[model samples]
Target: MRILFRLVAAVATVLVGQTAVAEPLTLIIARAVAVPDSVSGQAMLSLKLTPDSGKAFARFTGANVGNIVDLSINGAVVTSPRIAEPIRGGEIMVSGTFKPGEVERIAERISAGDAKVEVDVKSE
Candidate 1:
């Protein structure tokens, strides 16, 4: 009975220690995507980019698309394309989060369709 109590106490101590440590979440690009449009005479493909920040992690979801190597998310390229595609789907949802302790809030704008859209990203 005494040995059993000791074992339980040791386990509880370990669990408490683990919880005391604050582990921040990290962001990673899971995949690349492509998007096509009728902007030009040809089926022009421009990635539907979503610039996100301020969270511990961010998400990027989409199908492999253009030769465009990376998605410049609020001035930072957090994702890269595996291959190029003309007509793609669900690529705009590619998710990415700011690196733990690396994300900040920034005031910026980006070209969306034809208008400059405002954006907020964690400053470096």
Candidate 2:
């Protein structure tokens, strides 16, 4: 599918310690699919970023190596994974605690181009 992913709102500010603090950086996704895990044979979400988005993600991950990022679909939080290292290849795999058939439905929604995939970077 030809998906156009971009960052709608790059950053939002919140009141913290009587000062404006930026947290929870949001990134829209381009392409996604539901697949089986190679080792465990469980359902997982595979996300592929566009070239531009790949660069952006690389920069984001590179800067925030030890931070946690939340993956969500249609405002529902899916998984919050710690950034171990910079993901320069643009491929992100999300394996969460999914109920039976949940991953399939999510994949269908994403394939139909109706679901909104988001990544929220949390500040420490």
Relative to the true structure, candidate 2 reaches a TM of: 0.71
Highest lDDT model number: 2
Q: By TM-score, how accurate is candidate 1? A: 0.24
Those runs of model 1 whose alpha carbons end farther than 4 Å from true positions after fitting are 1-68, 89-91, 96-124
Summing lDDT over every window of 10 consecutive residues in candidate 2, give the lowest-scoring window: 8-17
Candidate 2, residue 20: lDDT: 27
Estimate, for each residue in 1-124, the C-alpha lDDT of model 2 and write its tens digit.
2232223222222223233222444444577788999899999988777777777778877766777877778888898888799888877888978998898888778777788776667555
Candidate 1 residue lDDT tens string, 1-124: 9999999999999887752222222222223233223342222223333333212122211122222334454445554544343322322433344333222221111232222222222222
Question: C-alpha displacement of 5 in model 1, angstroms?
Answer: 95
State residue 7's C-alpha deviation in candidate 2, in Å: 35
Task: Show where candidate 2 strays beyond 4 Å.
Answer: 1-30
Scored by lDDT, model 2 comes in at 0.73
Error of 2 at 97 (Å): 1.3
